[model samples]
Target chain A: MNHFMTSIFLILTLQFTGVSSSLALADDSIFVIAGKNSSLPQITATDLKLIYLGQKSSLAGKPILIGQNESIQESFYATFTDKDMTAINQLWGIVIFTGKTDPPKNLKSDSEVIKFVNDDENAIGYVSKQPEGDSARVLAIQKSTTTTSK
Target chain B: MDLWKNIVFSCRLFIFCLSLATALATSVASELQINGFGTVGAAASDDQSGYAYDIRNKINYYHDTKFGLNFSSRLGQKWSWASQLLVKRWVDDTFDDNKVKLDWALVSYHPWSDLSFRVGKQKLPLWLFSDYAEVGFLYPWVRPIQEVYGITPLNTITGASLNYIKQLGTVNFELNAVAGDSKVVEDRNGGIVLLANVKRAQLLTFSLIHENFLLKANLGKSDAVDVTQRTGSSSYVFPQLKYTFASLGAKVDYQTHFVWTEIVTTHVEHLSNMNGLYLSYGKKFGIFSPHITYARYWSHNYKSVRADTTTSTATTTVRVLSYVPERKNKQQSLILGLVTKITDRSNFKLEWQYIDADGYSRDTTERSTTTGGVTTTVTSHGNTKERGFFDAHPRGEVNLFSATINFIF
Candidate 1:
């Protein structure tokens, strides 16, 4: 009886933890920034998908370079595109193996992402939406009501 | 041939180094990035069957080795070029003089996000990767399955291509149109002719994403002609759709594959209707990726016809000759392969394939001739039929094992 109760408790606690972590991530903000300090056009989710897919090489006449944490590729897809990590990876495989284009360069952390994006004029990258300081600007929230318009 | 192969190999190396030195020099002078890629490998069929019965009839499948070099460079903002050189033997005798030759050369221009164009000598883009089929680094296998891509004419068109990109609600579409003339080469029947010519091909591809699902399809067509032959023309319509997913670690776990096939179909010309399909599953464990693929190819069935005439008359005797048409050609193969990433920019692969061919017949017709003082009808059809039961090539069934190493820098 005691073992069964312990098992139930463990399961409930793990489930709660998963839900809370997701909720926490939802509360966090994702920042989109350009390589230069010049005012850049706000990017929509649709454009974001295009850039990653290699379908669109540039934005506003400038080539866009996207840098994301290696692990974040899956997380970003799950949250933004409603796709499991596997589907997104497979999509990239098909493109890369076909000799169409190169895969995006992976970075270590959020700070590196900001530095890289802020350094290159044609660069575009992402970070935690709710970052601390004014290092980079948040282009738009993932699937938020306000981001629906241009 | 050996001497020539050595010379060509050295020349290729020299050119490769020269390009590298130039790229490095330019990298120091400007922000432009230069990279190099190549695949150097060899394949030998355990079965002695030649590339075709006519060519391989005397020498068998292990005539010699196959080697190639591919190089590419990025010129500047939106211009690039690439080329390939291949060296192989058609028959065992060096007198046959197998040598190295330029396969393709082209310049690519991308002006905007919505448009890119390529002009010069380029591979006919019949399928998704047909343009880069010989570039092993870009594909998982050492070579494409012969049953499907094998029959596609290996022609280089000198022309231009236009590519367009469009966005739908939740999908992206790539539109491409290519126009050019096919390269001329020696035909299989020891005749000179053009494999493809004055060709125009169009590709329409769309990718869809619904939740974790990914779906894609490509459709294309080509119209070409054989100049040397007597009004020989070629036409093809191919379509392929695939859905893939990643399962373990960083691997594409499954692929749902399908393809439609047809070649030039005409009575007077070379009429061939062949289709191939493959289902593959791949897993990537770090740098090593192992995949097993099952593919099949089949040609349209042909019926045989025979005519006979016998007459005897006292006042008037008459004799006639009749011709019967028949179709008897069928071939299939299965390939298993494993590719390992030796380094970040290098890969090595080993593959084994089983090939089976049947319904091969030699000419057997009778002719009436006058010998001495009497009329006689003689039949001539007594050629030996070679068979391949094991992986050896004396017969039709055989195995092909090959290893290849590719590098990109």
Candidate 2:
């Protein structure tokens, strides 16, 4: 009976490790989609930050919209900028105080961003995962991973 | 009844215009945005025996309060506008001298990706950070070295400027040209004087930056149309370099440190040549920062002409003394400062400085020798080689303490 219990414990531990590893890999793989009809070159993390902060005057020498979906963009912001929602508000406060720039236009959905970008050639935005419509294309992918040690 | 209808119509029109402006700014103008910054604080110096001396002689003394606001915005494509307002006291006994003043108002334009143009009143781009030097939030010090930067004019220009910036791999080059009229009127205790002159300025800089290393060379020249100005036409050149080493998860939170040194040579066409050297070292933590700076200024013939008047009815013949209006002055100072970030939008800083000056005195005459029962008289003139009853002046020392709060919204 003691031997039987030991074998059962080993089986459960192996299964749990496999499941957790796959979950970590899945967490790292992220999908990025453009708004409606933006033909911007693939974006890097730096480019995304610049566009959202309204620092990039134009994309490829052409002006682009600095619009984003509040909820979705908020996630990307927390992960990358260390500037969560509170930090974002403070950043805007500085911008307003300096009288240098204004807060970006916030949209509610991926579709709205798509429509806006599609309507203007200079517009650029992002959506979670790959987009389904032909009006836009995938920009890039962001990956994070977890490591476990015995 | 008619007036009521007109008022309602005006109100509606105003609301509609406001909405339309907001909509267009958000949808159409990708490059335009308006932002502002402000700071309101009280400053008091415990060193009542001495004065609070900034790089520019003395900015304040005793207990005083100062407040300032700045507004800047980018236009649709290439244009931008900026303005600043400040109120502070320059009084020795009290804060009654507080007055509001316009610090800057300028319009800037970018003609090309590598070239920018600016017109109207603009800040002189003499140093690397001159463009945003006044704003305290961006810097770790309560104030930059005032003596080195204070002598330079703060603002003047009713003309235009052209700037070119280009990048070749890791190296960036910048060139600027300014032309037009530079006139300033300082209103102090109801006394006013107008400073006018035809002005011209040029700035050339070459910068090479790589990750944690930065190197730069700056050369500047300014020519005044006339010699009536205190800071006559002068040429200034300096070179500086800095190395920064910091990364994530180091034993030290900031692990980054930088050391920078610069030497500036100032040559006024017909006057004296003032040479200055500045050295600084700084370190940063995740939130805390500390820096130390040292500067030395020396002039051969420190002839800062305070008054040049011609008396019509002179009793004696007009004669020029061999050493007239000649005096040499030297300044040495050390500053220790700290910066603390309270929140994302709020920051505060405290700093202390020690300044010493030597070789500043007027010439006086005394007895040189007495022989054969006859006393001989000797004349001691300013900057003269003759030593007649010479007296050494004690070194002037001053300690300064100041604090400031900065916020943006």
Candidate 3:
């Protein structure tokens, strides 16, 4: 009886299928990194939230953006920013449907993010581990990240 | 009337121009992005009188179902173009015959980080979520509060808008101005539909957006030209309409909880005036979120005109009898819902609503008397039929159950 109930529960709950990326795994620590040649501002947690939410693309310098939905560290990065990948996607859905801006580019791996940031002086992305070899510079979250941005 | 007759021609001309412009734009563009959203919903209502919210005694799986596709491309750092195609079933329209409506097809130019100019087809920016109301996954409930959101039919327009974004301390403020014309299609029967042409439609919206908070104000005005549709021999019972509306909205969003509310007042030229408000609250528990809302809509300022002529002459005296039809549409409801986030792009939601409404039916009658060498007629309006907001005749109240699977990619 217990096994039958478990099977029924699984059938009911796991039947919903979505286009999920295999790269979505929550990591230990996430860092917001940009190109070393970029003149990024002291972005608060709120400002970073706005960037991920597709509200603000730039601050002080050129525009900032997030990695694509299929990014390997997207879940960890969103969690570090006090958000979930679903929440971020919902917000971007609103902005994109309004024709305000396009969705993020497909950066399937952290190494791709680091490479893109290294090439573009205006680009920004998040990674699970701290980048090395002066490839990218991690900006300081000016406000305390312990508390949620909102 | 002429504009209504020439709607097909106008739409063709606009489509040609837009296609030409897109061709010119894509000639220099190299990247194209496609995005879309869809919802499959089923709803049921227990109402003995008639249908309400498109739900009758049986389960309805098509009323709330919809699909949308948006294609966008960037021409350069300063120019971009976007267009959306939508297919959805509506009340009075059968399944497998949903109309493919062009929600928006516009080109945007951004010369600065804070300024943007767009021209073409755009959604009227009336309320906070009115710009993207079709995306069911973005809202807390199975659908937006129908009491307030269903007050107008001018959903999309073909015109131009200017947006100016500014930053003030900790808040991001945006001022949006829209000017255009719209043709709203109103479905009356399976074959007969009313087409209303809105002229000189203008709207202004001011929004202050924060990471955890939002405040918005909107003002809009429009005039409708009479255009009746005829297929075979059926005609619509639509009136020539005009309206002006003003609204205010606020939202407090957090990772664990959210509170949202909006209030609006609308004054119509020949129809009834109305006021509506809805307050919603929701809290998250891991993958499950439970939400609740209280909404109320009422119509007042019922207009009555009195004209008296000579009813008695010579040797006979006549008594004047008047009857005026009462105009009303009112509703109040409590909605409870639950949402489960199944994945980053999909969600499952279930909702139950308890609604109380009145004033949707009326009867027209006239009293006339002939005296001496003249004839007199007295025209009046008022009847005693209590029809609810979503039903032809309900059993005083109603209970509705709904479920949907929403997704975007």
TM-score of each: 0.60, 0.62, 0.79
DockQ of each: 0.09, 0.10, 0.39
The lDDT of model 1 is 0.51
Per-residue C-alpha lDDT of model 1 across residues B1-409, encoded as one tens digit per residue: 6566567656755665666677577766553334445566656665444443232323222222344444454565577665655555432223244455666666778787567787877665554456655556656777665555654454456777776766565555666666665544434332223233434533344443322233444454445443333113532221121111111111122333212122221121233344555555566664456767665555442332233455655543334333322334455666677876654345788877776765433444556654444677766564333222211124546667767876654
State the weakest 10-residue window (summed lDDT) of model 3 chain B: B301-310
Off by over 4 Å in 2: A1-35, A46-58, A63-120, A123-138, A141-150, B1-32, B40-75, B78-102, B168-174, B185-198, B208-216, B225-255, B258-261, B302-324, B363-396
User: Which candidate, 1 or 3, has the higher DockQ?
Assistant: 3
lDDT of 3 by residue, B68-178 (tens): 777787676678899887766644333234556677999998777788899999988788788888889888878778778867656788999999888776688999999
How much is the lDDT of residue A134 in candidate 3? 85
Candidate No. with top DockQ: 3
lDDT value for model 3: 0.71
Q: What is the C-alpha RMSD of each candidate to the true structure, in Å?
A: 11.7, 13.7, 7.6
Cα lDDT tens digits, model 2, B338-379, are 866655556677788776656544543333344454545555
lDDT of 2 at B240: 18
Q: In model 3, how large is the Cα lDDT of residue B208? A: 94
What does candidate 1's lDDT look like per residue over A31-103, in tens digits?
Answer: 5666447365888887776676555667777655567665354456555655434345444444443324434
Candidate with more favorable, higher TM-score: 1 or 3: 3
CA shift of B79, model 3, Å: 0.9
Candidate 1 chain B: worst 10 consecutive residues by lDDT? B241-250
lDDT of 1 at A69: 61
- Looking at model 2 chain B, which ten-residue stretch has the lowest summed lDDT? B243-252
